[model samples]
Target: MARVRANPQFCSSKNEWKMKNNNERTAAVLGLGMMGATLAKLLLAAGYEVTVWNRNKDKSALLAEAGATVADSPGAAVNAGQVIVMCVHDYAAATSILSQTEQSGWKGKVLVQLTSGSPAEAEQQEQWAEALGARYLDGAIQAAPQQMGREDTPLFLSGKNAAWDQALPVLKVFAGSPEWLGIPAGLASSVDLATLSGIYGTMMGFFHGARIMEHAGFPVDKYAALLSGILGTFGEFIQLEGQLVHQNRFEKSESPMSISVDATARILRQAQESGIHDKFPRYVAGAFREAADKGLANEELAAMIKVLRG
Candidate 1:
């Protein structure tokens, strides 16, 4: 079994660590899924010596054609790189791959896990990595596979400060802006999940809106075009809402809870009348009404945070 005998040490200071040459910085990508393949390609484009390994040998062939060294096994891949990135399906799959690899090869390696998982799972993975004397960084990729090498690709990362510093150079190659959340291994996952929650909520609203418009004999494409205009202003609204929630001052209102509740009630009625599924509208109306019932009727729409907290 291959084992990493020495940890890749870097200065604790924030100053950038210089490599003897770009080729000296090696990275190994464990999975060759869409996102993982894109990442490996980005590293290769950045001139890093990249080693790739996938469960299916055929998957690594494409990367090899692009100048990546294909490893025969996970242990060989781990041994070939200083920075090891895993983009497997989930925390379980990631651990399973690692378990099969020579355990000793983990020492002194920096393991960047971009697997989708809960915060608790990230923490567990961090502990497991630490036990093996490996530095672990939990990360979440905020962009799609096609956006991997773009300058705007955002990667949320959390881990020990020293380890983060050590891994920054290789990480910067893939992410245009790699945000360091904190030392807690689970922070990146938590933030990622929170961000996803808001995105999914907005998507559900759009889906419901589209369904309602279709039921009303309206052009769905036209509705989508009109919605795009309104969606552009959501960023400003979100900023204001965040400020209000942070300050615990939801009194001043652009749109009060009562008004939103009433508006949502109308939406529920429309869905019901059109014989369309009202589940999404009903769920939203319930939250708005709950806020109003809590005596926050005059408060801004941001006051719904109270109901959410409960």
Candidate 2:
């Protein structure tokens, strides 16, 4: 068992006293996948008495050897700690475990769900936990297992103020600053989905660019390296574009929509000429063409959001 030590206060509000008074030195982890196991290990290393449970008991061996109490059942794990962190495959797996747990033991517990799920699932889970008298917090871990416990690791959380206060110390073990989006439990999941879209959208463009490099006989590694070098500047541009969209001020500033319109068309044309797949380029070009037709060619690149809104 890990040593129990008084957690240092991290908040300056009135809830500071309550947080210190209710500081829990025990935590329960209700999943053993890579992310879940990483969380449990971090908690244990922080000197918390960690209780862990997984569907496959064999997965608990390493954690048990590292001074963790391996619970035979989810209910047992829940009963062992005041703060219960659940990070499973999906909402379905999490729901199955919830169904098997003793509902009565949930009262007064802080249930932090780090599972990847839809906003609706998070909303529903929050309601379910509230009905059982548990403080529910929905969180999205925006980092991989190896990225855990980093000062810059992104962890978005949303829940009641009291719940946030109660879980602050435990959350800090994983992230130096856990971003509390708002009181709505679904906010974290919604942000997670939006960020995922950005990631996949960039990936689609990268794949098409890779094809272009391959067809042109250019070194793909050089292309990738160039992208890596310019990504920071590109990210700043993206942030500016996001601001423009958020403020609904799309007046041409840095880059005009007409530029992307021409660029995307050239990409599509090249795809056709090279006899490579054109689906990605076609979709991108089609969007820009639509925006151009909508008289947004003179606007900023982020004016594309107007078309997206439609």
| Cα lDDT tens digits for candidate 2, 1-310 | 2222223331223134336555367789999999999999898777776789998888888887776778878899898889999999999999999999898999988899999999899989999999999999999999989999999999999988888888889999999989999878999999999999999999888878898899889998999998889889999999999999999999999999999999999999999988999999999999999999999999999999999999
TM-score of each: 0.91, 0.92
Give lDDT tens digits, candidate 1, residues 231-286.
Answer: 87988889889999999988866777888889999999898888899999999888
Worst 10 residues of 2 by lDDT: 2-11
Q: Report the alpha-carbon TM-score of model 2 versus the true structure.
A: 0.92
Model 1 compared with the native: what TM-score? 0.91
Runs of candidate 1 with Cα error greater than 4 angstroms are: 1-24
Q: Name the lDDT value of residue 182 in candidate 2.
A: 81
Error of 2 at 127 (Å): 0.4
Backbone clash numbers for all candidates listed = 2, 0
Per-model RMSD to reference? 6.0, 5.4
The 0-to-1 C-alpha lDDT of every candidate, in the order given, reads: 0.84, 0.88
Q: Which ten residues in a row have the lowest lDDT in candidate 1?
A: 6-15
